[model samples]
Target: MNSPAFRIRYGFEAPECEPQLESLLAHRSVRRYSDQPVLPSLETTLKAAAQSASTSSNLQMWSAIQIERGEKRDRIADLCAKQRQVQTAPLFFAFLADHYRLASLAPDRAERLEFTEFYTMAVVDAALAAERMVCAAELAGLGICYIGELRSHPEKVREELNLPRGTFGLFGLCLGYPDPSRPADIKPRLPMNSVFFSDVYDADRGIGDYDERLSQFYREQNMGDATWTQRIQDRLGGPDMGPRASQLEDLRRTGFAKK
Candidate 1:
């Protein structure tokens, strides 16, 4: 898996490969899961891993809500645009960009949390923490998927989670044991030259041959006739990016990502 994953991800093999690199390259968003229950300890380990991630100014401006399996989880899944993975996963987490706790500690300066830069910092902090947890889960052989639909109906999600004014649901995470019958493929990414740069940024290092590569990959997976560029344009050009076009107002109302 290491050798193939590395080859597929980079379009070439590394001169030397380590087990950690293999684990990282092997990542695929797993949506289908088996009926096996997730160990309770796994949540603790993941949270610990998340806390270990670097935060902006050590502000720790992120929090998460784990939805236990039941009616609440089903409601959350429906809120996330009927994403079945959220409903079926053994563990579901709504990761939040939170300034509410910190603000409570100093009521007089709570207004500082309303700034756009602070909101951006919180969003980045939450994303970093969530990624660390995802890495830990993958290392432990647990399958995971990130659900961005949580932001689609920001006010509704806030009401459902009982979120405070200075906290916003940034995304959701689904965790479970992978159903081997429904395997996930490694999606192709842009070439290293296209994304990584030295010193000054290189804006012209386009997608290279990724379109063709991903087109074939999609066809092999029977995922319909959508190229990478087509998908990107369709998602970004339209107002319907999963009902999230008007979410900025919701964020402003919730005192997050405002400017």
Candidate 2:
């Protein structure tokens, strides 16, 4: 009971944890960073770790573009809703769901790239690879924040990155040494029973308990009184997805999800 991982993540008690479980449960998004740089050698190692992730049928339909500090980096940061971490992080990477490489390799048989299934596969591949890289970076004492706002202006990102027809800018990542002064705290999640169902789905297992816990967390973090349910409502209850509303059209233009 009162295991470190459970305490930090669920605000409850659980059995003891292994080191790897503790590491995974301790993840937090760090926006403020120290001036310490992530070395190029370490970057390579992290990339290798990403490459080690499993791919769909070994097609490996994903790629990452490192953006150094420059005009292009600043432009991309602006494109990602002008996030301060994006502009200032020591290492930035744009993870792409890329079908271009495979299509190019077999140009005559590239018809399948336009299907939604292929698009989904590419996105899954990119996510898996990026997660592997993130785990490796965290193990190396580096912190990261993911920028899903990269999809806000997909066309602009495509043009800026010189991406081909079958490559989509899925997301961006910011990595650096975390600033001690502005440390991030691990946020609580719903109870395991609420999510991990036994045999069949159980709608009766509501998130009322989690709402109370997350409300407390929000108050402690000075993040206002919005509970997780309220947050979800605010995000999804409206049709105003801003520029992301054009995502389907953008994806089609980029030769994905056409089916």
Top candidate (lDDT): 2
lDDT of residue 139 for candidate 2: 88
Per-residue lDDT of candidate 2, residues 1-259 (tens digit): 2357578677766667666656677789999999998888998999999999999999899999999988999999999999999999999999999999999999998888899999999999999999999999998999999999999999899889999899999999999999999999888888888889999999999874888888888899988978889999988888788999889999998889999
Q: What TM-score would each prediction reach against the true structure?
A: 0.95, 0.96
| Model 1 regions lying over 4 Å from their true place | 239-242
lDDT of 2: 0.91
Clash pairs of candidate 2?
none
Evaluate candidate 1 by giving its C-alpha RMSD to the native, one decimal: 1.6
For all candidates in order, the CA lDDT equals 0.89, 0.91
- lDDT (Cα, 0-100) at 222 in candidate 1: 85
Q: Report the Cα RMSD per candidate.
A: 1.6, 1.4
